[model samples]
Target chain A: MVEIQNTPPHADAEFHHHHAHATTSRHEHGHHLLQVSHLSVGFRMYDIDAPFLSAEQRTVNVIDDLSISVHEGEIVAVVGASGSGKTLLADCIMGLFEPNAEVRGEIWFDGEPMDAMDLAAARGHGISLVPQGVSHLNPLMRVGRQVDGFGYSRAEQTERTARRDKLFSRYGLAPEVAQLYPHELSGGMARRVLLCTALMDDPKLIIADEPTPGLDLDLAVAALDDFRSFADEGGGVLLITHDIELALRVADRVAVFKDGTVVEETAVANFASPDLLEHPFSRALWHALPEHGFSANDQDHPIPIQSTAFEQGGSSDGGDATC
Target chain B: MLEALSITFGYAKGDKPLYEDYSLEVAPGERVALVAPSGRGKTTLCRLLAGYERPWSGEVLCDGSPLPSSGTCPVQLIGQHPELAVDPRLRMEKTLAEAGDVSDELLAALGIRQEWMRRYPHELSGGELQRFCIARAVTCRPHYLIADEVSTMLDALTQAQIWHFLLNWQAESGAGLVLVSHSPALVERVATRKVLIG
Candidate 1:
């Protein structure tokens, strides 16, 4: 995996818009991997009234002047309330936005201007994205083949196979699952497969959009840990999530987006401070967190060996409170 | 009352059985929480209770009678992912309408607005969509509701509001609530009794 060293050129520094109010600017190594400047995406509507033509371009801006940077080897989590442009930002990053939607501003990778419509080009230059849904994989394709895409050389094959196993273990999945199709896998398994494919290319930056949106705590933590490991290993991670618990727990730095603007950005070291909860919106979000009876330590506690489905009466062991 | 007796089921080809033999009973107006590690059949049990799937063995009893497969059962199951619950092609209004008439009370209780009804699934946020899914689940007026992480995506305030609405609905309707969540605090707040699954 280390043989594919992505020494991509640094994008122009002018594209990064540093917020005047940003308190901490301690970025990880590697120059700005991606820089978005004065970017805004919107669409036109045919139903709008026009002077002559029946069709009109009604601009519904999904993301406005959304400038965020992911340096090499850093986990930057984009946290926001749902419908707050988090996914749209991710879509723009992945070049998956609709053609009808007019996208302004520039997305640069490795000091190169990224063509917004070309996912393959974006993917080739050390960039891969795992979508919100695991449906990114071809339903008919086996997980192994889905992850082990064709490349040019013998080394590429070896790398792909090695990376596949690494991902399977990193994501807490068994190697045998490589033979299963997307539909054959469980929700969690499907997600791991999507993540494996994203990591298979060893991209300089990996973007995960709500990677654990609806998963249980145990699974959510495990998924985040996998992403964190990637970041720890000199790779960049852009996490798009609405879950503050995850942002607080896993993100090294956080950017809060509201109505297409970056409302707040704080280092996770200071996440528990009153300043983090002081923002009205963040406060509203904080209060909504479940008072799950267990504390953070409890949340991370490893599952005991006794925890298995078979132990409980197949279907009839009436619900029991006893552990 | 909702009761399951020695239910056993697994995917047709899958060698691992999700439920070997599991039984659970929830009395009227009881709020039970089912907690377990991931992939431990918490969802399968909810499906059986909700009548979305049948148990390979044993029978599901609703109100002391065997649950009928053809019609809407007395139980509703809300999966962890709200996006999966709502059809992508349908608007929120139509999604709610599928349950029956959309009442203002239900809309307000869910913090959803009349304007939202016109929007598509892609337009709504994760939190809003989840609430809408919950409202739709209750549209048939099921006697028992199996909420599988309905509030998983929601922020704190919205979760509290939803919990309040659910508690009030349970009290007023005298319906049982079977909640599945990994959040211990959530279980504490809404679950009268907590059942831990492996």
Candidate 2:
């Protein structure tokens, strides 16, 4: 069910490049590239009596009072504990949600108002998603085909092939990897391919969810640097991760996510010290860094970024985790 | 001691061996870090030690005996992706049940909530799902544990919590550990001695 399918392009997946100015920027969050304001998402319980046949009963709010913005050429990181409903926000942006879900938000992207349909329609044109796990890659398809993505004419396919090869080579992945299945590829190679797929689209906004797990130090940093390059090219990124330290390295601003909502959104420079931070949990997260002694004094709220290095190795390449 | 004796390994389709004459040893209660840059065969070696994969020429022996082919293996492996190791259709509690008699203390230490048990693996985040895997493995009381990048995707706070519990568990159980980690800070704290694998 998780297999990659030949992706059919949305009816308007082409380069629209319109500002489509918002009649009412309700939150006054600036005319940023991506603005999410007062977003409230909840899941309704299925009717216990009717079960499969009935709709919602009670709404359990998952994300409430969430407001965040990403300006052009800026990477806004939404850092939170894993499973703290961060992906729900990305899902809201991407217009993916369960049938029993209740979502309420005013999202403006590229100066246009967005509901679920607008967000769904904007995918891969105005925005692209670098999804979390390698399983997002289609197992049956060749690495190159998936990276090129679906919905292209033969001529466009050929062009995508060329760009895919170029992107592959850029990541130090062998060009031959295009012909290989996902199972045949190593974990690191799979991650790079995922990143390459997001990069190939050249969308105005890229939302990457938990993208650094399988990478090595240099490669993880390299991936972050790639996002920087994307932002430098006048794009925007909503980088969602549990790694605050990694996020601090590249993000211009940080939005600390708590139980289903953002508790604080501040500049990365505020991480200079805990005193500069506004939230108690955010301060605890600062102290939780490995350099800060890896303390999880707040037992209920425990999460961290990566700093461990493989202290020894011979000459190395970045293609795979398994030889 | 757990020993990988003169192992020569290569994927069946590959033209060359990934590891040739590679030997390593871990005595009981020793926490060994397998450190290397990416694509250096660190994970492959983990597979060999845990009896998940067989070496072409050499053998993995534990306590002067070959690892058992069936039954509960003494070498329990906690792989990188917890989703891969769990069944999608089953609830979390059912999957944990497959591991047999998991203690309440183990559950509490990992910060696993009772509510989480009813959900499927896909419903939980990677960090939360991984806690179940660690609980299942540790409950077996294996003589050795192989942790391959166990906490890479987790937050620093959760990463610290998991490792703290692991180190304490290892000390109490005196189970040897063979781990692959990307964090030097973690390696500095967890590994007693590190083996470099290329």
What are the chain A TM-scores for all the models, listed individually? 0.72, 0.76
Native-vs-model 1 lDDT?
0.68
Per-residue CA lDDT of candidate 2, range B1-198, in tens?
899999999886567799999899999999999989887889999999999999999899999999999888999999988888999899889999987988888898887776678777766667777899999999888999999999886776778788888888999999999999887777887788998887
Query: RMSD of candidate 1 to the true fold?
Result: 10.7
Question: lDDT values of the candidates?
Answer: 0.68, 0.76
| DockQ, model 1, C-alpha based | 0.28
* Residue A125 alpha-carbon offset, candidate 2, angstroms: 2.2
In terms of DockQ, the best-performing candidate is 2
Off by over 4 Å in 2: A1-30, A47-56, A132-202, A299-323
Candidate 2 residue lDDT tens string, A1-323: 01122322212111111111111111122356777888887766543335565654655666787887776776788887665667778878988877877788788887788878888888877789887656788888887888887888999989999998888888889989889998887767777788788878778889998777666666777778878887877788899887777787778778888766788877777778888777887887887777776776663443322111110110111001111
Cα lDDT tens digits, model 1, A180-273, are 8878888777777887888777787898877775566667887788787787777778887766776777777777766566666556654554
* Predictions' DockQ, in order: 0.28, 0.30
Estimated TM-score per prediction? 0.78, 0.81
